[model samples]
Target: MRKNVGFHSVRSFSDRRWLLPFLASLLVSFTLFMATIFGLFSSQNVGDSLSLDIVSFTTLDDFENDSIGTDRKKLLDQPAIMQEEAPRIAYLITGTKGDSQRMRRTLQAIYHPRNQYILHLDLEAPPRERIDLTMYVKGDPLFSQVENVRVIAKANLVTYKGPTMIACTLHAISILLKESLRWDWFINLSASDYPLMTQDDILHGLSSLPRNLNFIEHSPISGWKLTQRARPIIVDPGLYLSKKFEVFTTTERRELPTSFKLYTGSAWVMLTRSFLEYCIWGWENLPRILLMYYANFISSPEGYFHTVICNSNEFKNTSISHDLHYISWGYPPKQHPLYLSTKDFNRMVKSGMPFARKFAKGDPVLDKIDRELLGRANGQFTPGGWCNQTSSDEMAEQCSSRGDDSKFLPGPGAERLQQLMKKLMSQEFRNGSCSSLQYDQTKRDWITPKKPA
Candidate 1:
């Protein structure tokens, strides 16, 4: 009986000790479970608050929600929202020293209340000229009222032959994308470039076409160009220097890249906003890689975008293979095209191209273009449907009214441009796209147009 009592007491004590430890474990688990639940709830609440803030911000800044107008406040806002309205163009007009007047003239010639314009006077221009350009944009009653025009206060030093030109263009594109403007196409022009037709004509012609089409002239790099452009190394001093200088070529040459095919063409282009977004954001790796590679290539501007679009599977088919500028190159083409004059006017008119380049400053041909093609008078905005059209005060109040810009009154210019578009979109031109080019792996050269069969 004594042995049984002792054993029973010992067993009872051991059971009590085990029970205490089990209870302590349960309490610790319960405390941790409660903490996790509280943390999840707190996190969800914070996330909900942030989501609401983002939603509210996007709704307020959306341009598609409001009617189109010269709303300066909304236009100046950041993080632009694209609108699904009538097609609008965004223009980047670039110039250097002694080009303020020419830039202004080009601006006025291509001005439309519906479109967006950003003028870039490069770093070479004096501060006084930049200020004068800004004042001209601000002081004009029509420009002030429309508010689509902007002068880039900060300028970039551009070497025409180097990547700096491409940088300036991309910088302008980035600014346009940041603004609250809705545009379908992005067109880059220079102080020497002038419109052959009215903005009404251009807008009208483009309205009928697909917005995805990119008017960039491109061809595979081969022959002498491959040796000169693709193999040579050049340095653009404008990249780091404060002053303008010519791009210098290095003594050594690089072997042509085997990973990607090289392409080169006219530097002037009318690119789609979507394609420009791809180039700028680089969600895909191709554009970024090509940009780095082209950094050292000679005449990077002429080849950079061309190579990018041709290599991109998503954007290659969208290329139209035309630059849309009636540029006349000399026999064997001396570095630049000849300055167009009155002698070229007949050819320019018949060419049906919307724009032409390398025109002499204050040329009589510009006066003829203004009077005959654009119906624009001296120091006046190009007359369009947006202009005030009262017979009583025709000349004075010609462009005073900020009328509806979406409604374009296109004339013969539209017909000519339409014909040109038709020709460009024909089967022959469509068949000559980037995909049609055949690459010979053995010879490491692009075969000429595959001989049709």
Candidate 2:
């Protein structure tokens, strides 16, 4: 009986010891699983790893929610919202020979954390300059980290005022679409162009508008001009040659194209990614037809996209018929607008246009714009809340360190931009701005069509 009792006690103690360890192990497993589930729902900035130090850029400040706008504040306050209302932009800044520095400056002027930019030094530029451009794009720290900005690796020779301009534009768009998935809009600009509004203003303004609306100036071609432009058989050598060449006119001009009515307008445009996707992706045949049609046309960039958008029944009404660029032309209207100077600065500001074209490189007006309009110091990024590295004591370059990118702090520029948005969206201008433009002298922004001659 003594041995039996001793054996029983030993068995009970051993069983209990094993049971305790098993229970402890179960508790630990459950605790670990709970911690993991909690972490899965927590917030994480998507851009923590992705950085784009587009060459020639100085900094990128973490985006602040309040800094963005009022509407974004509510959405950002919630932890499980899982997304931001603020959208991304992909820009194509194209420049010709000797315009490389201006392209860099325009890029720096419009730089932002939520945007992707593709710079193109067209065939008009020397190979050395193109290499310089690529070096700038690849060497920037912020751009390298973000991995957002990229220069066209395979440069194409472009002819001024020819089909190659359109080709280069399309090529850049294709590359941007393939390389990045975050952009909402595709904007094309030239070296002679510069930004009038801040990124904050433009981004915030776009967030409120429908994503389908395309900002392009367009007009229906008719009568004498239609017959002349439609039938012109011009061949561009830029597509075939390895060196600089001009477009040649065949001694033959054909009759007007009855199949599709010709449309002509400003080449500058802000196109939606969806429309660009339609053009790049072969889901529809309309874009393909227009591409072939404009292959031999003069100034095809000015007409290809215009015709494509207008001809497509699906995309016709989506046109806003405004290029969103401020261009001051000579009294008689020359090929390019007069060089913008101090005399045009106030008018430029009051115009409330986000972008302006034909500014001479190294012009003092550009310096004045950088100082007064952009609030940018020499050789630095435009001041914005994204830059936190600046000292709190005064507005300074503080983006040396970055914080959360989800936040935004918009400024007066945003409000003025909103007014411009309101004017564009008003019912009075809706139809007139779309497919039909009627110029109104009272409002410089209003367009009234000239009678068919």
Question: For candidate 2, lDDT tens digit of each residue in 109-166?
Answer: 9888778888888776788998988888788776787677778867788887678888
- What is the C-alpha local distance difference test score of candidate 2? 0.75
lDDT of 1: 0.83
Model 1 alpha-carbon drift over 4 Å, by segment: 1-84, 392-396, 435-453
Candidate with the greatest TM-score versus the true structure: 1
Candidate lDDT scores, in order, read 0.83, 0.75
Cα TM-score of candidate 1: 0.80
List residue ranges in candidate 2 displaced over 4 A: 1-84, 390-396, 433-453
- The estimated TM-scores of all candidates read 0.80, 0.75
> CA lDDT of 66 in candidate 2?
24
TM-score (C-alpha, index-matched) for candidate 2: 0.75
- Highest lDDT, which number? 1
Give the distance in Å from residue 292's predicted Cα in candidate 2 to where it truly belongs: 0.5
